[model samples]
Target: MPPVLVKGALHFMLVYARDGHVEILKYDLRCSCLSLVDVPLVGPGIHGAAILMAMEDRSLGFAHVDGLTLHIWSREMDFNRVASWSHRTIIDLRNLLPIQNTDERLRLIGSVEGSDTVFVTTDLGIYEINVKSQRWKEIWKSEKFRALIPYMSFYNPQ
Candidate 1:
């Protein structure tokens, strides 16, 4: 998964198939150190995960597939400047897509640079999801691109 920088904090998602656990590694740029983020009980069936920033707030999103339903959960970082996370049910993509097939694989590829929109790739196609509006738009089909990894660039005017 691609890493995201939010408020000078570098975030990386680590997914393990052994227990189907998804954890985040946060590296504080100011302190120049790394710390593991305490994630809530995500349970099993985690397909993919990614970190996104919306309105200056960092959020962790995970995709869980159960049968024919695709569940997405977003966890926002606590505003109290503490090392805590709160989970929120963002959306269920099962009905959003045109095709309704259990064989479709969904993964959180990466987020758009300088935007809250995140890209999710499925076996059928690639979709762009807006974190704030909770809207989805299919950018391209799976045949258009073999990979969905997004490239982000940082520019400092100062």
Candidate 2:
């Protein structure tokens, strides 16, 4: 189960089987309610996925990065009501990332708070990808590094 927090709620990605349909469960902590968010058919090559929120507009973002390409989907979400989100493909990272074949390993780590950028780690380095701008920047690189594990947090100054 892959989980992400969007608009102060928990969204979980539940995959029933390999190469099967995917469903999202939205859990509201305030009311302790869980609702299923229907999703369209997902491709079979999806290996890495992440949920993101655009900081400027607070729109929801979903990314599924396969071995040779990155597929991004986004939609507007209303937290106050039980609304069904409709997503559309926004960008493809094949032009940006150096992917030669389907053997390359890629993983969508997570998104940065207060920004529309999400982090993806490969064998080469860690990259920051902006969903709205369709841009990417390499933040870290190491020849000996085989994988990257990321940690995220929100800081509140009240």
What lDDT score goes with residue 33 in model 1? 98
Candidate 2 lDDT, 90-110, residue by residue in tens: 555667765444465677776
Task: List TM-score per model, in order.
Answer: 0.67, 0.66
Which residue pairs clash in candidate 1? none
- Which one wins on TM-score? 1
Candidate 1 lDDT over 102-132, as tens digits, reads: 4766566666655556666666778887756
Which stretches of candidate 1 lie above 4 Å from their native place?
A: 16-20, 47-83, 143-147, 151-158
Name the weakest run of 10 consecutive residues (lDDT summed) in model 1: 47-56
Report residue 81 deviation for candidate 2 (angstroms): 6.0
